[model samples]
Target: MSQGDEQRTAKVEPLRKARPCPECRRPSTRDNYPFCSDRCRNLDLSRWLKGSYAIPVADDESKADDDYRD
Candidate 1:
């Protein structure tokens, strides 16, 4: 390949740094490596179980409240 062609070759983007586990602040593994192990993952899961994680459930009646009634 010509020098210009080489220049045209796509540059490899560096992978972003792995995020640390919320429970231990330890670097997470590619395959359960970051948490150090599944135990850590479960520890994080427990937090969610105990109300650490919450997803808002929309109230069905709220939509009806906005509807016009005959």
Candidate 2:
């Protein structure tokens, strides 16, 4: 077999997981995994940049007590 034959046979499996896109719920591509397309990916990024998504934080009673002591 030629080197070309060996090269052709050697294929790399996709390491990225294939799942539904978070933004559009469409099948994800290898290039834009977790998102279906550039548009969807960009939209998600825009939302993040715009502070549309917020992380919920719980008020720690212990921290609050310490603040009052000082």
Candidate 3:
């Protein structure tokens, strides 16, 4: 291969460093990323789909009622 072709085909490193998989706590893979494998990735998705992960909201019933009345 020519020098120009080599330069064009050279692999570029990711700007951010790889982090450990959130589900398995193993080194993440380039293919799966954020997760070590498809299993871990799907597990996380399953949790989200099943409502296992949720954002907490503070209950303010009085405030909500006031808004509706206004």
Candidate 4:
């Protein structure tokens, strides 16, 4: 391999480290990414669509008070 070839064939590292699937807890694949398979990916999506996942927000009492104008 010439110097030019070596330079051209540089090793490319993945931007993020592979992690276990959130559903099955299996090693993730390049195709499915964070999930091990399509099933796991779809399952996660279904959960989101079904409102199984949610972000909690604190109720602002101050804002509630502001809604009532004197």
Candidate 5:
């Protein structure tokens, strides 16, 4: 309504998305998020199954040694 209000509105603008889906490059929804859709999400999953994903594990092998020590 006023200049101050307008200035405040401008300062507190709506948040924007980083980018579209990486697989299909389509605009992503908040539900499906970065994948865009279930198909794209599954595709990404398949890529993981195809050895694209690697979950890091701790390199410290202390667990095995701890049992033997005690």
Candidate 6:
């Protein structure tokens, strides 16, 4: 194969860096990505299901006052 052909076959985009698992500080797997294993992934899911992880909702004073008047 010619050098030009080999160059054309090469990857055009930059490779992504491997991110550590959120639950455990370990290299992630293809199947259980973002988490190292099923156990770690399940634990995270349980937290969410049990309302352990919450997103804080800021109450807008002006909007609430106008829209939700009794």
Estimated TM-score for each candidate: 0.43, 0.70, 0.72, 0.68, 0.49, 0.62
Q: Which candidate is the best by lDDT?
A: 4
- For residue 15, model 4's alpha carbon misses the true position, in angstroms, by 2.5
lDDT of 3 at 52: 97
lDDT score, candidate 3: 0.92
lDDT of 2 by residue, 1-70 (tens): 9999999999878787679999889999878878889999999999999999999765777887887899
Query: Which pairs of residues clash in candidate 6, taking residues 3 or more apart in a chain or in different chains?
Result: none
Rank by TM-score (best first): 3, 2, 4, 6, 5, 1
The segments of candidate 2 whose C-alpha lies over 4 angstroms from its true place after superposition are 60-62, 65-70
**Better candidate by TM-score, 5 or 6:** 6
Off by over 4 Å in 3: 5-11, 68-70
Give the C-alpha miss distance for residue 37 in model 2, angstroms. Answer: 0.8
| Candidate 4 per-residue C-alpha lDDT over 1-70 given as tens digits, one digit per residue, 9 for 90 to 100 | 9999999999999877989999999999999999999999999999999999999865887876777865
Ranking by lDDT: 4, 3, 2, 6, 5, 1
Alpha carbon RMSD to native, model 6:
4.5
* After superposition, candidate 1 runs with Cα above 4 Å error: 1-16, 49-51, 56-70
lDDT of 4 at 56: 85
Error of 3 at 70 (Å): 4.2
* lDDT, residue 67, candidate 1: 79
Better of 3 and 4 by TM-score: 3
Instruction: List, residue by residue over 3-22, the lDDT tens digit for candidate 3.
Output: 99999999998965899999
lDDT of 3 at 50: 100
Overlapping backbone residue pairs in candidate 6 total: 0
The per-residue C-alpha lDDT of model 4 at residue 20 equals: 97
Error of 6 at 23 (Å): 0.7
